[model samples]
Target: MARDRKPVKSKGGRPSREQAAEINGRILSAATTLFLKRGVDGTSLEAIAAAAQIGKPTLYARYPDKSALFAAVIRAQVDAAMPPITGVAETATPAARLRQVGRAVIEGAMKPVPLGLMRLYIAEAPRHGALIREVDRLGRQAALEAIAGALAGAGGADAIDRAHVVAAHFLDMVFVPHQMRALLGDVPDEADPLHPTLDARIETAIAAFKTMHLLPAE
Candidate 1:
């Protein structure tokens, strides 16, 4: 008779907080890649789990379903696409600062990741309309806040109320038009010496703000 074998000890235990966070990051990264490549509807949780090297149960535990995972991916993209306002305008003239902020906003929006995410959203909007709209609202709010932060020192305390309104207009004037052109495949490269270049738009926006007295007194 063979000797009785010793009972095997389990090597598994709960993941450390850092390890859990790293796993979550991997899941989101994998999901984003799959969603962008295959479109959200075409991508499934099984695919995501396989890409992430995690079990389906793990993915489901973090995100109840595909929509929830998609929402998380979009939220992360929005956060990345909206640049931080801090230190962007420090030590610059008011007009210069506005231009810097506007440039940052445009560049952030035009980045490959954000553009890919936008394409994904547009393709999947029919089924995820509400989710997409909510994501848009959150991104817009964040952009407005960043623009407002750039306007802080220029605008006196009394101008605070109008800052957000002006910020919205500024975003529309400098960002929305360019972004629309970009989405339509009509956008010229930044290095292109063409009519209505990025700098031209920024200058025009500054002039409009000055004429409307929308910018605070300098």
Candidate 2:
């Protein structure tokens, strides 16, 4: 019988790509849980390392400080929540695709983890304005990219040029209002007959956009 060969490790004893990804996921997950439970000011790098079952040196090696780690966490969250450029079906009309994009934005914002982080961010904004802006830029950039992709079928350079303007209007008209209500603890309740659910809000916004000629033609 042939002898079983031992698995070869990466050069210089470094972790493999899969291992590195797993370690990063664990670290982010631990940090997110702890931060949500205790707030960013109350959480420490050492605690995060312990919760992740990794050494402090490893955590420090990846992130020099708590702020750096927090930013990484935010980036991961935003990346997960934001839809990719190819998320919408190409067969759909530009207006219908835009509606899908809007729905994605609202649903992503209302997810448990992102919602928790939003509350924490608002509470910590005064003291951590720079850090907040950094992550806020990450999310806004992703949102704009997704919005622009949805508008790509509208026209030529004009459509691309006006993408930023359209993105701003879309967020202001569809997203910001609902996000404010959510931030203020006004969540949708199916049992409550008066509650304005996200889908209903999206439909209303899409109709309004059509009436205002804001949405592009198929």
| TM-scores, all models, native as reference | 0.85, 0.82
Model 2 misplaced regions, further than 4 Å: 1-9, 85-87, 189-195, 216-218
lDDT measured at residue 203 in model 1 versus the true structure, 0 to 100: 81
How much RMSD separates candidate 2 from the native structure? 5.7
Cα lDDT of all candidates, in order? Answer: 0.79, 0.77
Quick one: how many clashes does candidate 2 have? 0
lDDT per residue (tens digit) for residues 40-100 in model 1: 8789889888888877777888999998999999998899888776566456766777777
Q: What tens-digit string does per-residue lDDT give for candidate 2 at 100-189?
A: 787877778888888898888878789789878888888878887778767665557877766666677778766877787888888777
Error of 2 at 11 (Å): 3.3
Span of ten consecutive residues with least summed lDDT in model 2: 1-10
Over 4 Å off, model 1: 1-12, 89-91, 154-156, 189-195, 216-218
Clashing pairs in 1: none
Model 1 scores worst on lDDT over the 10 consecutive residues at 1-10
